[model samples]
Target: MRSLTESDIRTSFVNCSKGEAQRLSVPRDLGQLPWADLDFLGWRDPGAPDRSCLVAEWRGGLLGVTLRFPPSRRGLRHRSMCSLCLTTHPGGGVSLMTARKAGAAGREGNSVGLYLCTDLACSLYVRGRKVPESGGRLEESLTLDQQIARTTGHLSAFLDKLYA
Candidate 1:
């Protein structure tokens, strides 16, 4: 992953109108983010808790999607695993994030959802830059690179659904 400018992030969005992308919140500390460790850049909108976004480099280009998730239900705690990186987290650490489908399907309210890290930090968790508070990574024989490959493979599959 490479450091991205706000312009790049805004322009990379695929499931929303240009005006909507322009209005959405981008991380303020873009320059300080751990780009080298990120499989994709993802963030939840601070002003709009239900809104989230993800951007990744795919097929020689940047692909981004805008996602929406249900509001959190307080006081409920459960163990859950991220579908992308396979890292498990306890309580509110995982979220069901959904992205509207691209093209006419989106216009018709079609969307896809995946269980993901609530904070959108799967890349960091998988690489040990960050850790899950309760649930943790499973012991596996696969090397770090192999784990990364598996994570990206899951992401690519999710992104492919949007392209369809």
Candidate 2:
């Protein structure tokens, strides 16, 4: 994925209001981020632990999504797989994240949910840059390119649900 500017990150959210997007925080070390290595950028809000964000280059433009999860990660320790990258986290490192649907459906409280990495780092996990404390790994039959494709497809499907 290409590196993104603050404006690109803030204005790309399709499911949030302009004010909400403006109030959301962007990563401080944009310049230092490993952009070329990521399929998408994702992070949990430091100030608001329950809030998270994901940004990716979609179609011909940038697509950002705001996500929310339960505040307490208590008792989530077991072998589970991230829906986005299919990586198994032995410490129950997955969180069920929900994205509010775009437009009126969102206004009416509709949302889509999926299990994802608690830290929102599916890209890093898939590429082996980051791993759970227990050390995560996928089956050998899947190549790195195949893993990338699955992760990208999962994210794209999630985005599609947001606008659908």
Candidate 3:
């Protein structure tokens, strides 16, 4: 991944109107981001909690998506999972990430919430940021290579849909 600018981020959006893309907030320190370590760049708008965005390169072109996160029920138990890494968390380190639909139809429809790792570090997880318990062993159900592939696949699919 390469560092991006606000212009790069906005231009990456394929689904949204040009006006919408121009208005969306882009990260200020895109140049400083650890691009090699990021499968995608995801961030919430500081001015609008319900609004968020993600940017990545897929298939040869840059892609980006706008998202919305509806407020959750307070005090309700969460079977938390990270959407980016698909990792389950017992009670902590998880968040709901929802993609806003493109066009008017999306605005009138309900948003979708995806459980995502709170830290939002899918790259780190894929690269073995830390042992996933069980004495630093990979899960028996999945080989280490499979895990990395799955993570990157998920990210690529998300970007594809955004640009499609």
Candidate 4:
């Protein structure tokens, strides 16, 4: 994958906000990534649980999406999927992730909780950077490049809604 410039990221947001495009993400170097396989890009904020992000590429541009994880008293439910890794769990591995809405329409606090893979592997998911599993070869269908692009697209759309 190619590294994305700040302008590229900003432009993606603009396009998605206008409903002219889908979401995308900031591109990072995929040299160290497993380029031969991947499906999406996913990552959690190192500093905040409430701040997680994803990105993907679509058409010819990048899409970045951000999500907010509010603290919830309800226990996590089973059979949830991680937005970043696409991993589904039968137990409490997923949480609700909400994206902000665009424009004045979202001025009143609107968000969504997407059941996500508990192991935030957006980066590995998109770039095929995975830890060796003891059992067998992990599902590696899409190339790392495709994973990054798809992740970026999803992310960009999500962020646009949040700030919109």
Q: Mind giving the per-residue lDDT tens digits that candidate 3 earns over 1-164? A: 67787888999775567898888877787777778777778787777776777777777877777766665553435455566676655444456776655556455663344666544666666666643322232354777677767887877665545323
Off by over 4 Å in 2: 72-77
Model 4 CA lDDT for position 145: 65
Each prediction's whole-model lDDT (CA)? 0.91, 0.85, 0.66, 0.50
Cα lDDT tens digits for candidate 4, 1-164? 45544455445442135342223333354445443343334466555656666545644655555666755454434355555445444454556776655446455656545655444555553443454222222476877666566555665555545554
**TM value for model 1:** 0.96
TM-score of model 2 (CA atoms): 0.93
Query: Candidate 2 residues 31-129, lDDT tens each?
Result: 999998899989888878888899988888998889998854445455777898887775547778899998999999999999988887788888889
Which residue pairs show backbone clashes in model 2? 78-92
Question: Which 10 successive residues of model 2 have the least lDDT summed?
Answer: 71-80
How far is each candidate from the true structure, as Cα RMSD in Å? 1.2, 1.5, 4.1, 7.3
Among all candidates shown, the one with the greatest TM-score: 1
* TM-score for each model: 0.96, 0.93, 0.72, 0.50
> Lowest lDDT 10-mer window, candidate 1?
71-80
Residue 51 in candidate 3 has what lDDT?
Answer: 71
Candidate no. 4 TM-score: 0.50
lDDT by residue (tens digit), candidate 1, 1-164? 99999999999988999999999999999999999999999999998889889999988889989988886663447678899998888777788999999889998899999999889999998899998886568998999999999999999999999968
All candidates in order of lDDT, best leading = 1, 2, 3, 4
Error of 2 at 89 (Å): 1.9
- The true-versus-predicted C-alpha distance at residue 124 of model 1, in Å, is 0.3
